[model samples]
Target chain A: MVRYKAIIAYDGTNFNGFQRQSTGRTVQEEVEKTITKMANQRVEIHGSGRTDAGVHALGQVIHFDFPYERPLEKMRFGLDTQTPDDVAVKSVEIVADDFHSRYLVKEKIYEFRVDIGKPRSPFRRFYASYFPYAVDVAKIERALPDFLGTHDFTSFCATGSSVEDKTRTIYEANVTVNEAGDELVFTFRGDGFLYKMIRIMVGTLLKIGNDRMPADSIPAIIAGKDRNLAGPTAHPEGLYLKEVRY
Target chain B: MVRYKAIIAYDGTNFNGFQRQSTGRTVQEEVEKTITKMANQRVEIHGSGRTDAGVHALGQVIHFDFPYERPLEKMRFGLDTQTPDDVAVKSVEIVADDFHSRYLVKEKIYEFRVDIGKPRSPFRRFYASYFPYAVDVAKIERALPDFLGTHDFTSFCATGSSVEDKTRTIYEANVTVNEAGDELVFTFRGDGFLYKMIRIMVGTLLKIGNDRMPADSIPAIIAGKDRNLAGPTAHPEGLYLKEVRY
Candidate 1:
């Protein structure tokens, strides 16, 4: 068997999520269906990770095996044409026979978007979370550094999560204001993430940024190790799986 | 009766057009429905002009008469709450009883957008017209001056138009490239425009920019006084009724 790796991007507006289920449209199902049609064989593709419903992806990686080999460009173009318009195989390459997308991940990055300082607009209704209240960027910037280290992120993960491991190393976290100053972007890069970790973290940071929470509230939230201690989970539509590095 | 004037804006993605239609949804119907409900009386509103289906507007003017007077702010807010998310009333005020939206208009400006130099995607599906090929901005600029002076403009008007007076004066016509240069905006300001006039003019300019027509082709097309001489009408989504000046 020959292993093939591909980078994918999707809008996620109409998708149930990145994983396949018995029903509903999904990014995984769309790509897998196209690959099956192109290769004339049922192929189960493994993604680096699963993004929640309404979460977008710009560089979600996946791997699958096939019985035969062909020109890489031909396979990529063939899959692209067959897949729906919302999902695309950005790049594809032949890899080692044993390569696995999920097991080999070294790091991941996610971005959360906040649309603020404008009248609620219909243009960004599906892509951004509109926050009408004023937020202090300096306060948010000052609070993000507290997230930059290995910690037990049980407070950030959603309740009833199945994973036993609650610890993750956050390599970098920062808040960037767009030039127009109407958008606030929270970007997180880490060794790995817990379920709904970034959204919870962003929500907590937004609370601090909006002066609802003190800037120094992070240590107590982390020390509590309780999901209820953190702020609410940000909306899924504002979250994007930005990158996965191997 | 008290005359009221409003500046309206709409996405126009779902509407049939601005004029009243028997079946499909239209801007006129949406506003009239809301106003009728607000006033509890049958009312007739006149718009500055009609916009084709799928067109957008940033500043469309309209006028109507209501028997009673209320705070302008209250009326504007009431209309906005009743309209769909894609449309809004930017401002409203009381006007002279004799004022008419269409009859008193002095000039109008329209802008058309083209998204070029990127793989076509669903994100801009309703907002812009995508053109993949390269264009010569200088060639288009050279051709625009020919549209500035008063002319019959028969070539730029759609066939089957019933207007007998085809002469119109174009005060300004220019092509602007955005800072990214990936977007080319054609802005036209004229005393008045005939049916499909701006769309056909932009189409002809685009053809010239793409090397399909010579930069000097404008004069002959105008002198021919025939709609068949001009390029095909551009897509409706890119057109916007930017402003109606009094």
Candidate 2:
């Protein structure tokens, strides 16, 4: 048996996210089917993490074991030949048998794009969240320092999550406005995230950015330990899993 | 009646084309409906040019006459309120009665993007054309200078065109590759174009760029006045009307 690691990039617009499901198409199923066809055997893939539907990825990491022995170049070529156009294996390499994508991951980064324009462009509808309202950039910038450290993040997590621990360390959190002054990008890097935590943090920050909430209220929201204390969850379309660090 | 000129933009993925058709929705009908609803009277819109199905526009020029009078700001707001999210009237201004979008246009610019990769990206599938082979950019650049002046370009035009004059001045033609080396953008600015002219030009350029045709053969192809001399028309999804100048 040979263990292989691959870096993937995909547009999750039509996918049911990364996990396999019987009812719909998924990124994992698509790659697995292609691999099975090439290897003439069933293959199970282990991904670094799961992404919600309509969320895109640039450098998602995954590992799989193939029955046939092959060089990294052959494996890369075979996967490219079998995989569909939407998903591409950017790179492949041989890894130790003990290597695991999930357990070995050190950190992950996600970016959310918001199109804050009165008239949204059709070209951007699938890639950005359109909010036709005013937002104060200074206010949003002032609130970023509050989310940099370790926190329970219970209030920011979605309700009914199965995860037991909500505490996560955020390495960085920043909000930037594009030069066009019509778009904003919110980026976060962290060790781990609870269900829908990033989206909720974005919403809460948007409210504060628009002056609907005070920057000082971030601590109170985090301390509330209730999902209702945070703002609404942003759309999945605007979120992208940008990178996974080892 | 007051004449109003407006700048429009749309993602053409959802519409049949710029012109109205009985089989499916068109951008023209959508804009006309919105104008009628806002003015409380039917209005006729004349676009500077027509784009085929699956093509997009960033700054398309259009003209319409309305009996009702309103401030430019108010009319723009009202039309935006009633128009679909995909199609937007970016700006509206009262123009001289004789200002015709099509006849008064001095130049039009179109952009075509091609992605050169084995595995296509799903997010960019709707926005770019994918070519799996490597292209010789030097050959394409060498062939482009031959097409920069006024000439009979019937050979570069697709068949079934209704226009009688095949002569038009090409103000500029440039091909710049993205830094990633996986994408190329072809930009053309000209007095006007015959039906599918830009598409055919792109196809022929790709042939030269890919070394399928010799760079020196471009002038001969244009002078031949035969569609067979040119390459196949490219896909419409990769084409965009970048702007219209009047």
Candidate 3:
């Protein structure tokens, strides 16, 4: 048996998410179905993690075992042909037999974009969130540093999370503006995340940026360990899983 | 009465292009309906041009005459609130009554994105075209200069074009890549274009980039005044009308 690790990218707009489901379309189901047709055997794709519907991903990692040894290029093209236009296998490489995408990943990066202008950009609607209210960039920037490093992110996670451990190590968290364009991108890289953690963090940050919360209150929110203490979670459309590093 | 010209943006994935159609959902129809509701008056929007179904736009220009003389911000926000999330009114401002989005525009810019990789990116599935084969960047670059300046772009347009003037001035035409990402964006700013002109140009350029067409043939394709001279028109998903300059 040969183990192959594939770098995946997908527009989750039309999908139910990454995992296989009994009904509705899914990224994993599509990939596995395509691979099954090509390999003449049922193949299961293990993804690094799951993203909600309407979210997106680039460099999302997945691993699967194929009985026959195929060239990386061939596997890539074969998978590409079988997948829908919105989901792509960006790269495929041979890996050690025991390699697993979720267990081996070192960090994951996600970007959430906000269009902070009065004029809504229709073209960017699917890729970014639009917030017409005034935002205090300085306040959000000041509060972002508090989210960096290991912390109990219970307040930032969605309620009913199955995660037993809330102490995730956030390698970095920051906000940057695309000066050429009037847009802001929030980037987060972390060892692991709870369900809807990034979206909620963005919501909390937006509240802080808009002066709804004090910049220095981030630690308190984390310490409270209460999801209700955080602001409402942002919409799913603007979030994108940019990459996963191993 | 006030004449307003707005820069618009929209995700065309769910639209049947920019024009108002009776049977299908259209960007123009959506915006027009929104304006009619806001102004309590029938409004007709004159767009710079119509885009095919599934073609996106970042800076599409449209002009409409409104009987109510409201603040630009109010009008912009009103229209934004009324329109669906897929289409957005980016900016609104007063313009000369003589100004027409189609006639008075100085230039229009459009971009086509191609993903040259083994696995297709799912996140950008609605925004880019996939090409699994390796591209010859040098050959594609060499052919760019020939497309600049004034030329009869008949061959690069669809056969059903009804426009009397096939001649258009291309101010800038080039293929540049994102420095950090595995994506290629082809931008073209021109005085005007025939129907399917940009898509045909992209198709031909893609062929040249893939070594299907010789670099020297671009000029001949333009001069031939025959649509058959160019390659197949590219998919609409990868195209975007980025901006229209007054």
Q: Residue by residue across A137-231, what tens digits does model 2's lDDT show?
A: 88888888888899999998989999998999999999888887878999999998888999999988888887889977888888888999988
lDDT of 3 at B155: 93
Q: Candidate 2: where are CA atoms >4 Å away?
A: A70-74, A77-84
Candidate 2 scores an fnat of 0.65
Of 2 and 3, the candidate ahead on DockQ is 3
Clashing pairs in 2: none
Tens-place lDDT digits, model 1, residues A1-246: 689998887888899999998888998888888788766899889999999888888788999997799798788777766788777666789999778899999999999988884344545556777786889989998889999899999999999999998989999999888887878888899999999999899889988988999999998999999998999898898888889999
Model 3 stretches with alpha carbons more than 4 Å out = A21-23
After the best TM-score superposition of candidate 2, give how far the Cα of residue B61 lies from its true spot, in angstroms. Answer: 1.9
The TM-score between candidate 3 and the true structure equals: 0.90
lDDT per residue, candidate 2, B1-246, as tens digits? 999998888888888999888888899999999888776788889999888899999888889999967998788877766788778777899999999999999999999998876456666788887777769999989988899999998997778888899999999999999887778899999999888988888888888888888999888998899999999898888889999987
Sort order, TM-score high to low: 2, 3, 1
Q: Give the per-residue lDDT of model 3 (tens digit) for A47-164.
A: 9999888888877899999998998888888787778878877789999998999998889999999988657666566678877788888999999999999999989888888888
Each candidate: chain B TM-score: 0.98, 0.96, 0.96
Q: Is candidate 1 or candidate 3 better by DockQ?
A: 3
